[model samples]
Target chain A: MNFNFINLQPYSNPQYFIYLMIALIPIILGLYFGHRFKTYEAIFSIVFLFLIFDGSHWQQGVNLLIWLVYEFILTFAYQYYRHHGKNKTWVFSLAVILAIIPLAAVKYLTAFPDNSIGFVIGFLGISYVTFKTVQVIMEMRDGAIKKVDPVTYARFLLFFPTISSGPIDRYRRFKKDYEKVPTRDAYITDLQYAVRYLFQGFLYKFVIGWFFGTYWLPKITASALVVGNANGGLKLSWWVLAYMYCYSMYLFFDFAGYSLFAVSISYFMGIHTPMNFNKPFISKNIKDFWNRWHMTLSFWFRDYIYMRFSFFAMKKKLFKNRIRLSQVSYFLLFLIQGFWHGLTWYYIVYGIFHASAICINDMWLRFKGKHKKQIPSNKFTEWFAIFLTFNVVCFSFLIFSGFLSQLWFGWK
Target chain B: MDTKQGVLDILNDLTGEDLSDQMDENIFDNGLMDSMASVQMLLSLQEKFDIDVPVSEFKRAEWDTPNKIVAKVESLENE
Candidate 1:
């Protein structure tokens, strides 16, 4: 019997976990006994990371190596500069630009056809790894992380469990957990959550996500296009609505399920990587939805992009009124978020759509805040808010799905 | 006069609620602050105490309560 160990993508199927769990047993035992076998853990992580980019994916593996070396140099160099009491804004900005170059190139290259670039220049989880790297660099600039341990930095960047499509753990938080072995009681509780999340993931991803995405989505899409085309101009049909809801549910289940698996595996390893989704559909507003959905990524954007840009703008007196400043910041945050999704028209539109919805939500909130007596506060209104937010979010997901581009232009 | 009351006043200003007695409670968990409010809080800290808390350094767990915020600000002020 021949098993292709090198070809396995992380968490792509149920069988991957069987192999993963088998490998994780040694780690579990080590953690259970309050001994963190660092050297062995490093080796284990390298082997798993190798498994992700080995065989046919070897080019990405090579790219990962090259990427790691430069990032290490850039990070350490910046750390040295910061440690030496250098805090020039331009230097910091230049370092950030250099750090983002590879990711930017990869994002741009993805828009072109395969082989057009002549060689592949990216690895799996490049975005997540870049997120971690950028965070470190920014924190270094802030003097928050003055000392950068090379070994720990490597471990934090390449933590194999959530490498691909991360819940996006912080370097400081991850390093803190990585350096300590959790107490036995704590480890047991982690194990309990691990088991719970793993099964919940199975239910959400394999069962419900399959029912919506695999079973219903294609049929609904086919009917939507057929009926929409027959109705002529703009392709409006009830099937499109069905497609929207189905696709939204599918996106939530599939992604939230994947995030659960990542978080669960992380817990088993005694690192509580943050959760990505938190009943996002039940959100009462777009702002609430962002807080619940893709929380790590959103928080990353909020901290790094939104806060920084807003502060910079405020410092420079770009907007005098605080309300106007925040409104502008929201647009910048979501638009960058959109372009980060891809260099596609649909993705841009999706970003703009959310930005507009959230801006409107902010206006309504501020209005309600001022005229508290005018707007009736009741359970029905709260429920209505949730309902409205859910439908609005689903509509945005439809834009994100590129179904509209397909529905109108017959191309995606 | 102290950093604690300054922090309390800032929290009160941001949340529109009197947080003086709620020093130990988590402002985030209790819905007294949000992402935007947290930024505003940080900006206010910069303005009042001259404690420039970088967004990167502003961990929610560390700054989730008024007492924690005061402590963080004091530490930064000393540094």
Candidate 2:
């Protein structure tokens, strides 16, 4: 028998879902009957995960396995240490650093030319997996997770639906859902949402996202560059504005669509993986946007990074005032977020831009609180807030897109 | 003062609203608390109770209600 090797990126096309749905039928049936077929589910996950890394991408698959082994050892060792009642701060810090080293290496190495590393060292979803591992390690340090079951940890890491990107499910939350089967009625509700999310994902990704990203984005980029070149000096033009909005819309639809698929599939398997996006464009402020948009990632940053930094700073008396402490935290959070996007000037700028925006937003909120009666709160003001936020976020996205870098320095 | 009253006092200070009667209500969902307020609440809790509350360990769902916060504080005290 001859075997054909194929690499199917998750949610790349409608046909991929057809294949996915067919495979999920058994798992869905088991859940509907109030029995979770754990073994079959594992097999299913392996097959799909294999397909993702098989064929030409096998090197990344190898990388994933190696990375998994490293993380497992680090996680279990840290858990073991914590269980022994020896929670040294330096040990925890070392564990956290060890957890992130591979990802940091991948990010750093991948920054250079393709063959610079000689071979690939990171897999798809490496950043997301790092997020999960770091979360587990941190929680262990906090005594939130006292035990690390190897199988459960493995299952959580390799849960295929959100593996590529994420709706970044926590280990404990995923474990809870994985351990129990939803009731028949609840499973039916899950199916309902699964179907709804699947269709909405199709609409957003295939139709709208395609129209903007595939259809309009190229045209707008071309026109923007042309117009900017003609005008010279930072290439200020209406086309740049068009590119900003179009790129923003495309970015939203594509990622939100992909997130919906991840979430929908997760529901089918009876794991209520969180939703990533929730009408982000309607946000009334930059902080609100972070809450609504890429919610899992933003919340991860908020809980793990921003909140932690604020607590540390406050405890150490790093700042004279709470406001200044928070401001510094915001800068740290967004700057790291920028660097995480890539080692690029524009990404850093985009991070700084958001940090500044959020700081300003905080100041505005304080002023508004002080003079609530003077500044009327009404429908008009609410709409105006949204409109202003939308523009600000779009401009940030423009910086994120690195379009200005290309238009000015002919580099992106 | 008891743990419940101490928690209520802190909640009132942070949210600037009387939360004594709304023991079961989700302060976050009701817009009485947010990310910023939550940080401030944690700081105040640390100062008042001298209990360590790591940011990672604070789940929003587990500590959403005033009663839940009271219980959590008591538990931390016991720990």
Candidate 1 lDDT, tens digit per residue, A97-134?
99999999998989997677778769999999999999
i-RMSD values for every candidate model = 1.6, 1.4
Model 2 chain A poorest ten-residue lDDT run: A1-10
Which pairs of residues clash in candidate 2, taking residues 3 or more apart in a chain or in different chains?
Answer: none
Candidate 2, which segments miss by more than 4 Å at Cα? A1-4, B16-26, B29-32, B50-52, B65-68, B74-79
lDDT (Cα, tens digit) per residue for candidate 2, span B1-79: 5999899999999877888888999987766787767888888999899998878778888989999999999999998
DockQ of candidate 2 compared with the true complex: 0.67
What is the lDDT for A32 in model 2?
79
lDDT of 1 by residue, B8-43 (tens): 888888878888887899987765677777878888
Each model's DockQ? Answer: 0.59, 0.67
